[model samples]
Target: MNQTQKIQNPETNVPKTPQMNERDFVNDQLTTEKYMTASYNIALNEASNQNLYQDLATIFKETQDCQRNLYNLMFKNGWYALEQAEKQKIDQTYQQFTGYKTQLPYNVQ
Candidate 1:
């Protein structure tokens, strides 16, 4: 039960050099897009002008999408990895969240 399982693709080898590799480039871009989206979220929250808010909102959506794309690409190339959650843990979490459904406004049950 203590065994760890990871979900990942076959890793692509890269020369460990001073220059950045494909994974590094994609990761950097993903990080940048994440930062941009966060900043846009803050700006949108405090934006006084409707037009400016709309424009920023559009750009935020685009940046968020770009981040997802980069993340997908990284995962495909084995640069990104994720742990596989145990079924018991997942079921417990699901039950916990389901217990909160009654607290919702409507009948989301």
Candidate 2:
């Protein structure tokens, strides 16, 4: 069938979504707020804990990896959001940076 016929007979092909009621919307909002509050508290507690720093560090590293993968996928497939030159510049800068390290300078006797 042609595009117009397909559009008119969408019920046979496309799935139907249920409409949300006021009570359902309120409940969803309440659940979202509850989770958000819990997450915020967890973050606050972790921020204050020394052991949690390590866990946070690991999470941060993983998040960075995920972001890099997404960037590569978006740009490599000609679906890049930014200009190619800008993307290349960012890639070069990231490559040039080394991770943080601690080293004390030698003291004269």
Best by lDDT: 1
- How far residue 79's Cα lies from its native spot in candidate 1, in Å, is 0.5
TM-score, cand. 1:
0.83
What TM-score would each prediction reach against the true structure? 0.83, 0.35
Clash pairs of candidate 1? none
Candidate 1's residue-wise lDDT over 1-109, tens digit each? Answer: 7566999999888879999988788899999989999999999999999999999999989999999999999999899999988889999999999989978989883
- List lDDT for all candidates, in order: 0.91, 0.49
Clashing residue pairs in candidate 2 (N, C-alpha, C atoms within 3 angstroms):
none
lDDT of 2 by residue, 34-97 (tens): 5555565567466967778677666655555555665454444433334234555667776665
